[model samples]
Target chain A: MSIASHALWVACLGLPALAADRIEGPGLGSPVSAQSVAARNTSIYPDGRGLPEGRGSAGDGRLVYQQKCASCHGERGEGGSGGHLVGRGPLTGSDADKAVGNYWPSATTLFAFTRRAMPMDAPGSLSADDTYAVTAFLLYLNGIVGADEALDARSLPAVRMPNRDGFVWIDAVQPEKPR
Target chain B: MPPVNPSCRAIARCVQSGGAVRAFSVVLDCADTMISPDTQREHSAAVAAQEALSMERWSRSRLNADDQAPVAGGGLLDRRLFLKRGLVFSGAGALAWSSGAAGADQAALPSLRVPGRGFSNYGQPSEQEKRAIRWISANRAVPGNGVSWSPLHALEGIITPSGLHFERHHNGVPDIRIDAHRLLIHGMVERALTFSLADLARYPMRSQMLFVECGGNSNSGWNKEPLQSRAGYLHGLASCSEWAGVPLAVVLDEAGIDPAAKWLIAEGADAAAIHISIPLKKAMDDCMLALYQNGERIRPENGYPLRLIVPGWEGILSIKWLQRLEVAAEPVMARNETAKYTELLPSGKSRMFTFVMDAKSVITSPSPGDTLRSHGLYEVRGLAWSGRGRIRRVDVSADAGKTWAPAQLQEPVLPMCFTRFRIPWNWRGETAVLKSRAIDESGYVQPERDKLVAERGRNGYFHYNAIAAWQVDEDGEVTHVYR
Candidate 1:
């Protein structure tokens, strides 16, 4: 049989056996409460569907950084074991290993990253307000925002990154050299 | 399962659960009477103690020094003398102590179970195999400007575990959020278009089992002294996997590629914003916007949400965290293409864009560290692959390059994938060399070490496909050498 046909056959044979096994066998009980599981399953979409109701100011973010983040990220956000969050030089041409604040093209990515995986240990532990605060603080450190600037969902998307235009799509058929 | 005597069973099971051999007093008694004076003289105290109960006794008086003969036909000593084996059996006390020690060792071994933890949403490699990780050898100054080699020696089967796949990063691994990741296609296209990961997922997708090898792999082969490392460490940067994604043509069609546009510049989301210009024909032909690897979403170390998969091309071109594609009229002449990946030829000129990895083969088993026990029938096994096409043949040389024999190539030798080959070899006591050479479908044969050096010149650091030779001495020591 051809590889694809064999794979199909295996899948056909395996699915029923798996279904039967699951029905007949004792299953591992759900660990989390149903309501909590439902809440955790919420996924944010690109068209701004699942955005939470919260606002943060760059001034408030500076206080949050000093209180919680600065111990590891350094006072100026130059980074230590946690990585620098500010003062990025050139985003694309030649030297690219500066900092995330200047290089990242999307402010939405900053908020999303902080909301999902930050503080080294406890991932997904930050509130939406806290995530926005951290994003504002990081942007301020990169000289993208004023110390007292308020950052909300609308303002966050408008904050343009230095390397916003640095990237180009992968055109496989083209022969033009990279800029 | 009980362990049966290998000679008595039709099919011997090498792996057994318990000690099943019974102590035979009669066999032990017979073994004691068969040792010869010459045997005693040849075997030192340690060897004699180990063989006391097992070996056959020989008479010193009948054994002449000049003409030694076989015990069974009229060629050697008396048949009865050979039959009488040695019986210098170990005491019951010692046997009991040995068994007790064995039991203690078994008890000390850790159990493969968790105390409280249970199932996981995602799986990871076993803790015992943690050392089987990609050896990251990045530039010290730059956080992500370097390469990580796949631990090929520690892996089995064709698919490289996603976590251990090699990485060649121009910038650090970007923490890309799935929601924010957008692929933009602009420039010479009829209409500038942007695609979210969900939008790309809506398109029809195909999966391929292939290998991605860094062009600069085995560049150390140009070194004056042979590097002392495992075969995988020397050539582990290459890996094979099943990549699944949407066809590049579908996306290019959506963007409406203009006829004048010949080159496509691919850029990443990382800090470096690394870019590479590829031919438009190659992209529209077989390229893919890969989203899944090995039946799951691509790992963070790999291209998480999306990556450009250039089949059979250099790994660097398979840009991860793909962000943009700008259709252009001419080549971009990226830094990667000009400063790096360019091979300085023996002549003054240099060879650039040498993308496809040529045919290569290496013996993985019976390699450097593994040993052959008792010099009997042994199977020599290894893997061979080619980027140009399928591996047509793998020739194994046991007696150095003196004799070449075809090895059994495992079935389903897919193009641009690893093909396993094995051969049975009877290893005698004489010193010998082992090597393997692969010939691709295009009839491109792997060159010998000397031939490769002669053609490429001493300064050549890339595209090294020299035949690897392993020397085995009388004492069973295997070492790598240029033959």
Candidate 2:
């Protein structure tokens, strides 16, 4: 926040307002080892900034999806009580089957999400190889990827999503009105 | 068999029975004077004769007719009528003195003979009050990913009881040991640092009453028809509390920003590790790493130890059980922001990051599922709030939108907090439509359901802050309705 707003914030708390923004603290935070940072960094950016090193293809991922995801998400990502992960429904319709193919805008999200929380029953249980393979398998099922084409951290980020440019950021206080 | 004024109905029964009636009575609830303001304890023949004479006298002389007169369309009366003195119900409450049923149910105190139970280390609501609970609705396959609605209809005032606050879980709450829990702040910063729960508590903190509303709150209002449910079930996804915490600005300034950082990827420790990309600007604003809720160390369900408070923003952005903050130059396009929270319009385009819950209000008492057995005098109470600033005025409409009157707002109306509003209503056994609309200091008026849908198409499912309407039948049964 700007210094003026910061001053107002402090004043609202019934505290004396500070004329200038303080750039220093007691520095109570403790530093961590590189390994500790790596263990904690679970976020994967939109541009594939944190994709783990692993290589896999649709051919190698079919078995992984069947074993870990089929029980809830169905054998072909068609769904079995769980939300369908593969669908191409119209976004303008009420029953918009928003899934990977028609809704998800990034491919790295698949790996980032799988590595952090997937398989419902066992989150964080997938290895980098398993995550990459499962991501590729879902992508192939959605027709965004080929069967034999191997995908690693380098090539995965380059695979463009079908709805990459479909989203629009809104910061206005008003909602959209039809003409 | 048509609905009739309870008092007049009783008078008609008394006149039909030519002989001295057994016992003349009034609706017990309508009689705040205990057993029907002018009723005798004994149901003897002599007392019955005297009661019959009084009923005939009451029928001849209309009581409190001026006070019960409608100020606006329907039965709305002056908002201050409740606070004013005197004005006995007279002919207001449901004349429940059935010419059939005899004695008063609680004329004698049965609990006086039995000793009350001793107090405990922690107290709970009485067995009778246990009905006021969070109604859980989750996915059939993944029970963890669901919502539990608060019982707003069963509550009064503004502050939602901590235990009764609504909850939305992505993959269930995780059991985190405080000592082991660490908040990792990395990425674009001069120094990457970690703060334990103890470390965070030592910082200076401030308390403020603010509401956190889910983006998907009131999404059901976008349905083809009005949902027949309690007010909270439809809109209780939003809740207010007196939150105490260290400002996120303090922590961010201490870490030293890299200047290039534009976004912060906040992730929770739950099994879903549910993450969202927030703009750095909001972090520097009113955001706080909340350490306490409602003057307590927060509940296990409400992110104990630490939860981020993003004042007035969507509830999902609050990030409960918060664990990490990855500062970067761009957003991660998390599933929540891109595919879920985003609104799809009829034009085939979608709008994402529609933050800030606009002005909204709803009548809790006499809402759907509540029946008004008494007709004399009633108080219409409800909650009103806005994300922008303090609530300036809340107008209530009893005959759809035909007419409206300003409700009396509860005192100490703070910004971004729940402000209680109430108005006096004198129901005369007439069918009426009830509704309330909030106006924030920012000059934003809560839209009607039709105008809202006209602007934002049916495909737009989130951020629905439209006026809610309730229909009261002549028989006093209130039900949810669109008109």
Candidate 3:
């Protein structure tokens, strides 16, 4: 059978009218409609490519961060059960805790990761505005931006990370160069 | 009803070939003809001669510390001699049964005269084999965040039985209802697409026998002192299995990947929302959207319905319960790539996206917690593997690093899969240190513990592929040691 027709037949099996195929549907996973793609496209890129159109300040982000993120990531972002968000220590050479303020390379990644997966218990549950505000709050906690500074797609990508140039992409397949 | 016995089936087929009476007569005549005097005498004589020959071989093969014939160019015995007795290397290899030819040792045990339990739709390892289990190590504060180690030393073959495969979790395994699970392929694409588990199953599929090793495997090796736990508990983060699924390349091609897309940010559906950035080259090269593991629908902990199996890559990159693939020009630089899984090199610079595992081997049989038990003639067996390619050779050093002897690699040493290697050793009661080093197909040799430490420095905590050493004491106790 053609691939397109096969995809449709497989999807049609999920419908109720297909009485004989109902039991077999469990073995075959439920079909995903084409419309489902729009909702699932939630990842944000390093260049602020997939960020949703929204804006928020550190003041607004504080309430969202406390209500959602604070329990896992400590009250002051000092790291309790989750990762520490605010640390000025070195990123490498010594065993310094890699926190967002020092280790992260991109600020847009903060919004993308938190929006898609955050609060640890409930992921993709925060509103777009809440995600932007939380990203601003985390930046403020890290002393990268002011507490009252507003952030959106344009501003979040412009913020620089402390260890932006620390990472070096060494080829995993290559042997250690004769140092 | 009990499953049909092969012997009974054979008898039934014989009866069908001829009438029951004729079959009975044929059996009697065959037995009578075989027992005839002349034939009996000749058979007995031939048996006697064969037994004598085997007896001579038995005496020669018998364990004797002083009487071993030296191998050419080495003090150790010829490696071929180790395969003479029960070292059958087919499908899981031989069990090393130290008994008479007819298994007289087991004959002493009573047989069950009555019928036992009936068969079930599903099966489990015999209750007597309860020792094979994943040893769990979790964060006390967050029970969800933890890892369960596969009991590698207890298992026999290359394939890690699904139940005992190692598990690494950021947030505990989510009970995903397969019907609700959807995979999204978006970002730099001509057409963003969503596929259900059923849709993926309809696509063309492929199976590969490969190992998924956690990047942090052998992390204990980075410790200043050697860990004293069993082999599996220390370095069992890796497990091999036959993963069958649709190729991610086909899925991405269907979604129409943009020319500019160089990275794919794959994310899992777990509460932790664990995601990692995979290079497009690796994804298009040999990545699979895995649906079944070991010929069955994957278990919940293993990301049932769908997972990404990037052969020879770190385990985290092969995301479990994969939900989304965001094609992008650059990596996501997510917390996983930045905060964790990255290595701190001695040059004070950090190494990111170090995916492939290095060549390494460990003597699991003689590892810590396994007693030597007055070892006379023992098959020193272990596992060796390399991510670059197939294993070329494995060398065992009995006196620490003083001398080295080659071990026999089991047949079908596929790339990135576990290669079981065995060498026969005669252990007198004297104390000795044991080590095994592996060389991959690419001519890369596994470095010694000291050499690896000197190069990577103490700041390193991941990708420790140094040769592991075990110390055998005079009292027959085996312990982990850095020789």
In Å, candidate 2's interface RMSD is 14.5
Ordering by DockQ: 2, 3, 1
lDDT of 3 by residue, B330-422 (tens): 776777786667777766567888888999898887667766554455567789988898999999887887888888898879999999988
lDDT of 3 by residue, A1-179 (tens): 34456557767876544332212111233334555755666566666766888899899999998999777567888654455678787645545445678777788878877876676567779988999899899989889989999998888888887777777776432224311
- lDDT of candidate 3 vs native? 0.72
TM-score of chain A of 3: 0.73
TM-score winner between 1 and 3, please give it. 3
Clashing pairs in 2: B27-B96, B92-B376, B93-B376, B94-B375
Provide chain B TM-scores across all predictions.
0.75, 0.83, 0.82
Which scores higher on TM-score, 1 or 2? 2
- Residue B17, model 2: lDDT of 32
Model 2 misplacement above 4 A: A1-26, A172-179, B1-69, B85-114
DockQ-based CAPRI category assigned to the predicted complex of candidate 3: incorrect
Model 1 alpha-carbon drift over 4 Å, by segment: A1-179, B1-117
TM-score for every candidate vs. truth? 0.58, 0.83, 0.79
For candidate 2, what is the lDDT?
Answer: 0.74
